[model samples]
Target: MKERMEKRVLVLNLDHTPVGIVNVQKALVLTFLEKATSLVHFDYLEIRTVDRIFPYPAVIRLYEYKNIPYKGVMLNRNNLFKRDQHTCQYCGGDKRLTLDHVIPRSKGGKSSWKNLVTACHRCNTLKGDKTPEQAGMTLRTLPFRPTLSYFLAEYAERHAAEWLPFLEVKPVG
Candidate 1:
């Protein structure tokens, strides 16, 4: 029951654009207060009260359009790891991951999304103090800033498939 309650519910705007994610408790409150409507349910889950059982809301949409600002995803260690799918961009290793600058900071590369990538300890050491090209190494994927939809789509794929249809970014092959 506790674990189930921890599941996140997708919140969408009146126009069906994804706005944010809320825990089940907050989602229930919004629905009960008529601020939002449930659009999808987790068929295998339910919320039980003293005498009633409600279908677990997997997605909800607000009754009114909330003018939410679109702040970009935060750049941090965790987000960087997520963007790289936890694999080394240089060698594709999944362990001992570290951040690597495609262009070393020694050469004035800023720690921005385009300049950073995930690399294993070995790869980082091998490419130390030099750019990938200078070290005769190549990145498997170019790093880029991830949009909210990109991160949301990724989470939806793993924890909430119901949110997938409402998310703008679709899964690729």
Candidate 2:
């Protein structure tokens, strides 16, 4: 039962904007509490208890609009690599990935999106504690902060085909 229920559920704000994705359990809890309503249900799935069966929702919408604080995506290894498409920003190589400071921290570069790039181990060593200009290397792309919707779109892949209407996600080709 637990294994069957462990799926991603798309969550939307009151005005139908994508806010986040929650686990099925959280979606069920929200719907049961009347704080959210099921906007889309999974294809050909249901929750079966001892004596009752319930429709399993794939997308849920909040009854009230909650003002969430503005915070961009977290700074982490996985996300940094994702932003650069797992390729070295300096050499465009997709092997032995690592994070490199565009402007080395030793040179007062803050570790924000704009200042970081994915690097191969070779490039990382080559650019050690030096700006790309000083190291005679060039960055392939400028990184920017990813929005919540970007992560939300990635989460959409785990849901049922019936969820296409509610989430602003298109299938990745």
Candidate 3:
């Protein structure tokens, strides 16, 4: 029961755009209050009360479209690694991952999404304080800013396949 309650529910706007995620409790409350409707439910799960059983909502859509402003994804070490798919951008290695600046900060590089990438410890050390070109190293992929949908799509692939049909995620490749 505790684990089921801890499961996240996708929340979509009236227009079916993903707004955010909520815990099962919050999703149920929204549904019970008629503010939202469950669009998909976990097939083998159900919520039991004193005298009622409700389908476990996997996704819920609100009754009205929200004018939520699109705040871009935050630039952080974890997010950077995720954006780069946890593989070293220089060598495509998946282990000993570390964040690297495509252009060394000493050379006027800012720590923004476009300037950062995931790299292995070896690659970081090999590149040192020099740009990839200066070190004769090349990145496997160009670093770019990631959108909310990108992260959500990645999450959906891992934890919640039910949300996939509703999301408009472009392939990361």
Residue pairs of candidate 2 with colliding backbone atoms:
none
User: For residues 41-104, what per-residue lDDT tens digits would candidate 3 score against the true structure?
Assistant: 9898899989999999999999988899988788888998888888999989999999888889
Q: Each candidate: RMSD to true structure?
A: 2.6, 4.0, 2.2
User: Candidate 2 — which residues are off by over 4 angstroms?
Assistant: 50-52, 106-108, 128-138, 158-173
What TM-score number comes out for model 1? 0.87
Model 3 alpha-carbon drift over 4 Å, by segment: 171-173
Question: Weakest 10 consecutive residues, lDDT, candidate 1?
Answer: 164-173
Ranking by lDDT: 1, 3, 2
Residue 36, model 1: Cα distance from true site in angstroms:
1.0
Q: What is the TM-score of each candidate against the true structure?
A: 0.87, 0.75, 0.86
Best by lDDT: 1
TM-score of 3: 0.86
Better of 2 and 3 by lDDT: 3
Write model 2 residue lDDT over 60-164, tens digit each, in one string. Answer: 999999887767679899988876778999889999998988888887999988888899999999999998888998888777777666556555555455555
Top TM-score hit: 1
Q: Which one wins by TM-score: 1 or 2?
A: 1
Q: Is candidate 1 or candidate 2 better by lDDT?
A: 1
How displaced is residue 145 in candidate 3, in Å?
1.2
